[model samples]
Target: MKILIIEDEIALQQSIAESLEKENFLVETAADYHSAVEKVFVYQYDCILLDIMLPKGSGLDILEELKKVGKAENVIIISAKDSLDDKLKGLELGADDYLTKPFHLAELNARVKAVLRRKNQQGKNTIELRNTVLDLNERQFFVNDKNIPLNRKEFDILNYFLLNKKRLVTKTGLAEHVWGDNSDQADNLDFVYYQIKNLRKKLQEAQAEIEIESTYGIGYKLIEK
Candidate 1:
């Protein structure tokens, strides 16, 4: 899943991003309200970890703006404020969960997973499609009950396609989602092609009925027969 963290604490933000990245999530950050607003407006995220207290503006405003745009992006408020009023107001403004400051990173990670599970996985950890089964926690794929080994990039590529199944995903979108900021300096998308090819080969070898369609000059689509 893709996540946007709107926190003014640089150290904490970096820590959160790193932790989520290690968990195979596409993560981005915004230190203030304007950047957060811009990100939420332009890009789509499965969830947002927003700090109630920011430098330029309150994170509550960002939540309000998301609601105004009719964007149903799941939001979790993270702040030092432990007041019941703040929690109630944030929940009223559509926050999914609240995390107070000085909390454990592991606890924060758990909360994020809980919110995403409710939002996308319907509270399940495994994602099953066609003959393929993906273990979200283990980051493993199985076909016909046989485990398939996949490199990190290949696994992430497959996960991305599964997440957006039957949708046209551009090369740019794939790069951004998988490689993130580093993709900006990439001159060619041959790496993406290579990774997709590897993933497709593995799925085919396993007799999985899923296929990825290359959209010529565009991108790819995961099609399941």
Candidate 2:
């Protein structure tokens, strides 16, 4: 999963980013409001860790902007304030959960997982479509109950495909989600093409009931056989 951390405290932001990265999530950060707004406008994330307090603006405003634009990333409000109003206001603006400062990173991770489960995975740890299963926690994939081992990028791409099954996945969106947004600096996405080709070959060899269909010069979609 991809996560965006909107925080101004340098140490805390770095700590949270490092923790999520260790958890094998693609992590991105913005210390202030404008950059955070820009990111939400451009990219989609599985979840967003938002701080109530931000430089040049408040995180609540950011939530409002996201709603206005129809961005549905699960949001977890992280703040030092313990006020009920602040919590209520955030929830009203579409936050999935709130965490006060001086809390454990483990707890934060648990909350993130819970929100992702409830919203994205329908409260399940495994995603199943036809005969294929993608295990979120174990980072495993199975075809007809047989293990289909995958490297990190391949797994990420497959996960995204299953999550969006049958929906057109643009190349830019795929690159940004599986690779970091910074990957756009590369000269080409030949790397992405190679990865998809390799993964598709594996699925076919396994006789899996799913196929990744490509739209020439556009994108790809996951379809069941």
Candidate 3:
């Protein structure tokens, strides 16, 4: 899964990013309000860890902006403030959950998993569709009950496809989601094509019931056979 950490505390932000990355999640961060706004506007994330206190603005404003723009990325508010009004306000602004700071990292990880399960994975650790299984916790993929070895990029591509199944996923969208914002600087989408090709081959070899169909001149779609 992809996560954005919007925090002003550099140490806390980096620590959270490292921990999430260790769990095989793609993580990006912003230390202030403006950068956070820019990221949310440009890229997509499975979830966001929003800190209420920031350098330029309140995280409440960020949540409000997300609501205004109709962006539905699951948000979990992380703040040092423990006031009931702050918590209620954050929830009212559409944050999926709230995590009080000075908490355990393990607890935070569990909360993130819970939110992702509720918001993105249909409240399950494994995403099962069309004879394929993606085990989010294990970072493993299976087809017909057989394990399929996949490189990191291939797994990320497959995960993205499963999330958007049947919807047209533009190459640019895929790149930004899986490869992060740096993909915006790439000269061509050949890398995305290559990853998809490899992922398709693996799935076919395993006799998986899903196919990544090219949209031609546009993007690709995941279709169940």
Models 1 onward score TM values of 0.54, 0.54, 0.54
Model 1, span 92-205: residue lDDT tens: 888877766666665566567656755766667777898899887999999988999999888878877776677677786677557744666788999899899888889888
Candidate 2's displacement at residue 83, Å, is: 28
Model 3's alpha-carbon lDDT is 0.82
RMSD of each: 13.3, 14.1, 14.4
lDDT of 3 by residue, 1-225 (tens): 899999888998889988889989999999999999999989999899998888989989989889988774589888873455776788888887776666556556656775676685466778889799998788899998999999998987887678667767767667755775457579999999999999999999999999999988878989999
- Root-mean-square deviation of candidate 1: 13.3
Model 1 error, position 100 (Å): 27
Ranking by TM-score: 1, 2, 3
RMSD of 2: 14.1
lDDT of 1 at 1: 87
For model 2, the superposed segments whose C-alpha errors exceed 4 Å read 1-56, 60-73, 76-120
Q: Report the number of the highest-lDDT candidate.
A: 2
